[model samples]
Target: MKIVEIGTGYTQIPAKIGAATEIVIENLLNGLNNNGIEHTLIDISYSNQVKNSDKFELSLTHYVNVPNWLNKIKDNGIIHIIRRIWYSIGVGLLLRKLYRNKLQTETYIHFHNQFNFFFAYLIAGRRLRKGKIRTIYTVHSPDWSNSKKIPKKLFFEKIAILKADVIISLTNIIKDRIKESVKINSCKIIVINNGVDLNKYHPIIQGDKQKQIINIGSVCKRKNQLETIVNIKEFLLKENYKFVFAGKIIDHKYFNEIVSYIHSQSLSEHVKYIGEVKPGSELNKLYNKSMLYISHSKQEALSLVVLECMAANTPVVLSENFETFVDFDSKIRNAVKIISNHNLINEINNLCNNVSYHKQYALKQMEVIQEFYTWDNIAKLMIKKLAQFKQTL
Candidate 1:
């Protein structure tokens, strides 16, 4: 079987260069390759240059001529270029042209983002109805939270859920959200959590790690990083642990506010901002050299970074009210310290004080990740589902 994976928004295919969706798509392609499955990736990049390599075939669409304002809107997810009339018409025509030469069941198109899902619906929905080709969509987060309260977004999400041949949910929570938004049988939805590369993100030497706490993600309000800092202010004042914040500062105002708070609290020395670090060895090193990984985000759907930390045998602290952990295995859920803003300090202190407990949880998290969250295992599950899908056809 051949698979064509369409990336969302940009052209950085199969890497950590984009969002979590892009990283997940890359890992999925690697897993498929390991299993001897042939696949292709299509994406748009910031540059007009395009090339194909032996690793995988790539088709890029560069938007250099477009106005900066339009690019900004597309980049921020306010408006997707794929959904625009001109792009949609071109994509529709291309799909129709491809349909003339390929068997419907021989090829499968997978969309990693909702915009692309809607694009597929517009371009190939009719052909899908006629069995000209199959399509699958991975819903990163059936974003039902207040942070993603865009009516238009919700509408497109419902449409994608209803229209896709099969939908993959990163967690049961996301699946539940999809069900909440629209009526769909459970059979159409498959719960497949994002996976980590244990080989790449394994534990480091004990002496190499420092008494540091790390948070990797965009420095923004939705991440709630500033609130987390406030919640643990007293703890930071007392303990020797340093708080390290990484990732791009998408919201400049929020970033400034966080900086101001840090300055006001006299935490300039204790809090370190490394800006954005490209994923790979450097990121793995950051994960490995941390005593604790914290994600104080207001919402999430199975964070790949958290899994990477667990794979590296680093225990994580998350918001007590975090809804995504409901899909984690019991052992993993127990290993992660869930504390709300009210008790963040005490909870972290408890873990920090009990060195044995910290080590125990770290080891348990690593074991759980090895058994349940590796990309190899995730790929097998996905392939099994795809095989079943083929049988039904």
Candidate 2:
């Protein structure tokens, strides 16, 4: 059987698909090539075309065309307003018409996030009737729904998801959220937790201690990275531990606030804002050097960074927000000390002292992940289910 997977590209040296998402498919390919399962994966391209894949039989690097008049190209925001008005009406028709002539084949739909899935559905939903293809969506995060300038676009996201033959949720928590929000047969939604490669995220054997803990993703409001820095200052007192926030600072006002907070607290030296990581080996080196990976997002589906932290054997300290954390394994939870915005110093003190505890937890969870979360295991399950689709149909 041939499997076709489409995702944002990472085949290049500096893959934009984030570490965990890239690793998931890598592990999947590892299993597939080992088992001799033939497949193809197409990376979404920037130049409005599809590129060929060496590993997969057929691949397309097609891009969603930017309407000649992209609505949100803001110099003063009128275009954004116009785009918002047009997005609701034009997306469905435009997509449907664009792919009208081509694309009649059996394939699996892979969703990197909710945006593309919605767009695919709006444009391609009508095409499903003509072919024998099965589509699935993998949730990367809770509709990260870019800049506030872009309309939430939540309504279309749900509608496109419903059109799918199957919905592949990264976690049980994610599946339940979709169920709670959208009415559909429970059987249509499958829980395929995100996977990690043991070899890649393995612990560093070198006996060295580093005072800096890295928190990835852009330094935006949702990430709540400031909480970690603020708390570290309060908890560590001497201000020894450093924070490496490695991502773009999209919001200027938010950036100012973070800068002000650091200055007001006189903790500028302790916080280092390394711009966007330039992909490849440099990122792996950054992960290796950091002792802990921390995230304090107010909301999340399941995070790629958390999995990367696990892969790097860097224990994580994440927010105990209600939306995302409920479904993690008890052991994974125990290993991580979730904070609901608490006394920063004590939390830091506890985590800093408990390196052995986290290392053991990381190792244990790695074994469980290897058995179930690998992309190969997930693809095998999908193939089996694809075969059985007719019975259910």
Candidate 3:
């Protein structure tokens, strides 16, 4: 069987920076390559980066070069919608050409974004169905999980879910939410957690760690970096604790709010925003050197960073809303501290005070990551599940 992995056109594949979905696509492709699985990756073109580096098998990757102007358009705008539609059409045309006279049942087109899935359906739904070409749509984040009413974008997402032959949910909780909200066969939805590159983010032995706590992701309100700071303000003021924030500044206003609050409160020495750090050695090193990794995200389907931190042997502390781990093994769930507003400070203190426990916790986290959350494991699981799914069709 042939598999076609479709990348969201927003970022180039083998992502050089912090596009989590794009990175996942890259790692999955790598996993496929390692398993000797023959597959094709369709992605946007990157001028500076070689489309097929030594890291990938040359024959397995393809690039769709959109117009320069379209590529430059900022995300979430009307023009961006046009770009996605245009790209989706291009994808359809390419697929048509690739399988011109071949049996579509032998091919699978996998998607990672809602826009790509919905627009591709509009462009080639009839051909896909008549030809019996299986399509898999992975719900990266259920942003509308708590919405009172479906927004226009989410309406399209729901349609995409219904139209897809299979839907991959990052967590069981997300799969349950999709089943509750959308009228689709429960068997078509499967839970496949996001994974980390064990080779890239393995544990690093170190002496006593510094009093540094790290948070990685875009600097935005939804990530709740500012709130995390506020919640730990007493520690920042009275102790030697240092809070370091990294990742692109996605929300200027929110970043300004964090900066202003820090400066006004004379916490500049205790807080730092180091901007985006490139993945691989730099990110893995950052994870290793830190005393703790904390995520205060208000919503997430599954956090790649959290998994990466665990792989790097860093103790993780998560806020209550980061519920992706709810269905995880009890030992795995117990490995990381999940806190609320009431227990946030206390949990942090407890983790910090107990050095032996912290070391054990980090080891447990790494064990879970190696056993179930490696990209290779996730890729193999996906292929096994997809093979079973294809038999039903």
Which candidate comes out best when scored by TM-score? 3
TM-score of 1: 0.86
Candidate 3 per-residue lDDT, tens place, 1-393, comes to 667899888767667788899888888887877776778888776354456545565336667767777755566567767777777777777766665564834677889888777776777676667564788899886574454345676877888889988899887777777888785799999888778998889877677777889999988887889889998888767767999999988789999999999999899999999989998888998999888888778877678888899999889998877764345556458778888888887778877778887888888898888888788888899889888987786
TM-score of each: 0.86, 0.76, 0.92
| Per-structure clash totals for the candidates | 1, 7, 0
Q: After superposition, how far is residue 232 of candidate 2 from its true place, in Å?
A: 1.9
| Candidate maximizing lDDT | 3
What 10-residue stretch in candidate 1 is worst by lDDT? 58-67
lDDT of candidate 2 vs native?
A: 0.59
lDDT digits (tens) for residues 217-314 of candidate 1: 88787787987788777887788778998987889999999999899989998899998877767788888888788877876777888888888877
Runs in model 1 deviating more than 4 A are 16-18, 45-47, 50-93, 102-106, 145-150, 324-326, 389-393
RMSD of 3: 2.4
lDDT per residue as tens, model 2, 156-234? 5565557777777766766766776677687887766555555555556675658787888876787777776776775
lDDT of each: 0.71, 0.59, 0.80
Error of 1 at 253 (Å): 2.1
